[model samples]
Target chain A: MPDSFDNVSVSTKANVYFDGKVVSHSLILADGRKKSLGVIFPGEYHFGTADPEVMEITAGACEVVIDGTTETRAVAAGSSFTVAANSGFTIRVTDSPCEYICSFGTP
Target chain B: MPDSFDNVSVSTKANVYFDGKVVSHSLILADGRKKSLGVIFPGEYHFGTADPEVMEITAGACEVVIDGTTETRAVAAGSSFTVAANSGFTIRVTDSPCEYICSFGTP
Candidate 1:
């Protein structure tokens, strides 16, 4: 079993995002840190976030174009990347559905 | 936005199960409800649950064989089914990778 957090609660939202290709679930910890588990489908999508995010790819592969970057990085399962607050990124899901855990840092 | 559980916490275990096709993360609710979010690859898998399980398909499609049942049920996104405690079930992933939230009830 993975690290068990037998001390907290969670909530899930159905059919999130306007494109219907993404869904998110909320994981509330006792310490007040906030994070989300997101499932993204195949296609090119752009996302902007107000909080700095650490996106960990738990499954599938995709190409990410971070804001202000000229090159794209191909990330697969077990890899991760970071994006600054108030910035954005573009993800191209050409191979498979991507499952990720997006953790937001405290400002 | 989906239901936000900003008051609780969760822990995730990476690369769970022996088959390598199924990975599970642990979600600990404030009420002590034990559930898991699982990602299953394309194939047939048989699973046994220690407690009664309500399996909700959050993404993709598959066929499920509830133990002691004669016919299979085709489940897609937003659908769910139940498996009794201490019993087993078989899931056939024919079309795509399946993401599910499995909630286990108290015995």
Candidate 2:
């Protein structure tokens, strides 16, 4: 995974969610792919996706339960998870904040 | 004034502050200037700076009192506040979250 993205366009304003418990900055890559860099505080959050998405954890850890699944996977740093289009997942972060890069559109 | 920045490098990880009350993503401009896109939850935060900074509000609002100053300026969207080097400022956000683009190094 890349530590930083070069030759991209990023929004000045942030996408704030759950009263700032989660915040992200949107950016478009040179190839026109949209992604978001975000931080999730220690809490449980459920997010629905309009398109298939890949979430890569960059820092800290989280527990994820994908929709229609009973398994709760413990995801650590440098790990990733995929969610189906139009589906959702519940993520819980403990100990500290979890940072991630969410790639939208396709898994 | 620009909603988005073109041709830049952005970090995948975010800077979390005040136990996630404030979150920011760092990026570098084409000219090598450093900036951060951030959101501030409804709270008061005091930050010390090594370099002078210009904080431009992109969404919502905040009240700021620069270090050693008594005036509390109400800054809204499209407004900005400058902090001197080796100094700091106390920012308060009430009612709603505040979004800002913080430019570092110079005013």
Candidate 3:
């Protein structure tokens, strides 16, 4: 399973498989046309603080708390959604880390 | 950071962030039209055992050992390639776990 990529330097990223824990990482968002995205399972947050348009493709069912309001959204597998930039949200997993993919536009 | 998805049951998957270590997971391949894929960083393998046509999008440049032969291919960021099924390969990381995405078609 040891595979390495060339040219593109490996960056430091963290995935904390736990509840009530916060983890943060710095990402250089892609250009509007380039997709800069990654996956986050249940019990994790994928935050892109510098970009204005952030999108998440929910890979499982989960609850999202956006800007102080909590709502239950059933993000079907393979579906995608957008979260406005600077909109800090908390996602509490009802199952586990819900599998989801997210992308952000570079400044 | 905890979020859960509906309908889609959370499945058990293993990811070993190491070199020369082998990890395996069972996946239900999607239909040809439905894109079933996920990301794997450097020093890891994403193997789709059942399907005949498996595709991988290299998120970073890496070397891939197909079947029993070894070759170094620079898979530029955002480029995609297909691995014919049953063509088992071992990828040795020269950088780290190369970032890549892979999908498989259902039988």
Q: How many pairs of residues collide in model 1?
A: 9
Model 2: pairs clashing at backbone N, Cα or C within 3 Å: none
How would you encode candidate 2's per-residue C-alpha lDDT over B1-107 as one tens digit per residue?
Answer: 78999999998888888888888889999999999999988999999989899999999999999999999999999999999999999999996889899999964
Query: Worst 10-residue stretch by lDDT in candidate 2 chain B?
Result: B13-22
TM-score of chain B, candidates 1 onward in order: 0.87, 0.97, 0.49
Segments in model 2 whose C-alpha atoms lie over 4 Å from true places: none
lDDT (C-alpha, whole model) for all candidates: 0.71, 0.92, 0.39
Model 1 lDDT, residue A26, Cα: 61
Across all candidates, the chain A TM-score values are: 0.87, 0.97, 0.50
lDDT of 3 by residue, A1-107 (tens): 11211111112223322221322122221222322223344464534344554444434455655664557555655554556666666555555334443445542
> Cα lDDT for residue A50, model 2?
89
Superposition TM-score, candidate 3 onto the true structure = 0.39
Q: What is the TM-score of each candidate against the true structure?
A: 0.58, 0.96, 0.39
Query: Which of 2 and 3 is ahead in TM-score?
Result: 2
Task: Please write out the lDDT profile of model 1 over residues B1-107, one tens digit for every residue.
Answer: 12333333456533345334665556655666766666676789889978899988888988999888878999998899899998989998876668787888952
Sorted on DockQ, highest at the top, how do the candidates line up? Answer: 2, 1, 3
True contacts kept of each: 0.46, 1.00, 0.00
- Candidate 2 chain A TM-score vs. reference chain A: 0.97
